[model samples]
Target: MRAKNSFLLLAVILLSGCFVSKDTPKKEAKEDPYEINNQQDNRSLADVLRKYSSLTIQGDGNNARIYIRGQSTISLETQPLFIVNNTNMGRNYAAVNSSINANEIVSVRILRSLSETAIYGEEGNHGVIIIKTKNANK
Candidate 1:
């Protein structure tokens, strides 16, 4: 009889917690770039992203993770259009990371709004961060 009562009591407590949830809506565990806020103190561009994000941020002088907003537009039927120095930067954008010289960069800007990504179309689904670099001659 004691074992039965104990089990019943445990179940009641468990069920009660489900009915009495807090103010925040329950969210499933998932990756969210929004988890990292830019409001924190200024560290080097590389340090800021490397600290908060789960991904490894590797390179030289400076690096950044720009968080622009996702878009609903899906105009491109095939692949993404990645522009580098005003030209198409090819499909393997991630691979090109190693090729980027951090010392040549000026500053990186992050845009976290849907309006900001709409211009780029659907490739900016999670967001699009356009990286602007200094001219090689400079």
Candidate 2:
């Protein structure tokens, strides 16, 4: 009876170790800042621009024209200048739309304020869409 009771106690101890408490805390999954959540792999730069509240996109796809909402343009050109990885892509939206891949984009920033876009000179008079890609050196 004594040996049987000792074996039962050892079995209970081993079983208890296998079970986890329901109140135990779980580690939460961390979100990546550069990640564009719920976006498709084939998403275009125009699709990504729609996510931002400060800008407005007219039309669709390659022919799409982007404008800074609530910001007055100094020039007749409504299209904002595109700066990709510190390179001036001019005001042509079709060229930029085709050249850049949405998956390679790290971040997209809009320089709407005059003070913010003054560094780019006359080209930035309307606004600036600064695109930082994963491979900036490329």
Candidate 3:
């Protein structure tokens, strides 16, 4: 009778384990890019990105390719458009961002939505990272 009771108990425990819930609510992922104000250290662009969110910065130094959340392009070029002040830096946008001193920057705004980036035409498809410097001509 003792052996039978132990067997039944073991069976019950095994059955209960099958019904246990493994689906726990996960934390809501932040889709928006964080804004950094009062620019302090002249840290590298990749460093600034790493400090804010869980971004994937592939490559070295200022030449790194930054991948923003939910931003993907059909073309081979996955890099986002880097706009300084009111002027677009064209193809070498990433280079421009790396060369600029972080201390000289006043504000960094990220335009993620399709509507927000639509104004710039196809170039804005990937996403628009607008960096305003302290001396930017408004």
Candidate 4:
């Protein structure tokens, strides 16, 4: 009877460790509004951008039109400005992303708000997407 009681006590002790106490902190997932990390190589830039709720990608490949969720501009040009390697690639997001080889891309940074887009002036009134390519120096 003592052996059975000992075994039961051991089991209870082991099981008690598995339960999480209320005092134990829970982890929360933080949202990144600037850049979306793409680990999967199977998907294209447009496909990856589509995963973000803030970005709306229309068309495909070089013809794709990228738009921000809440645009405050009066002009019909809802397309966000694309900047590649510190140079402005105009308002064609598709051309900018498609022109560069996927392997050459290092990271894509997005500036959505007017304050963030202020550097480009009226050109960036809509929004801005900066695509950085891997340099031979690095």
The candidate maximizing TM-score is 2
| Best-first order by TM-score | 2, 4, 3, 1
Q: After superposition, how far is residue 67 of candidate 2 from its true place, in Å?
A: 0.3
Flag regions of model 4 displaced more than 4 Å.
1-38, 136-138
Per-residue lDDT of 42 in model 2: 83
Residue-level lDDT of model 4, residues 76-113, one tens digit each, is: 88888888778888997667666776555566777888
lDDT of 1 at 85: 43
Kindly indicate the candidate among 2 and 3 with the higher lDDT.
2
User: Please, what are the lDDT tens digits per residue for candidate 3 over residues 1-138?
Assistant: 999999999999999878846686777986544445544675766665555443457775757777667876667987777888888975464677666777676667777789999998888887777877767874
Q: In model 1, which range of ten residues has the least summed lDDT?
A: 62-71
Query: Which residue pairs of candidate 3 clash?
Result: none
Better structure of 1 and 2 per lDDT: 2
RMSD of 1: 11.3
TM-score of candidate 4 relative to the true fold: 0.65
Ranking by lDDT: 2, 4, 3, 1
Report lDDT per candidate. 0.46, 0.86, 0.71, 0.76
Candidate 3 regions exceeding 4 Å error are 1-40, 91-93
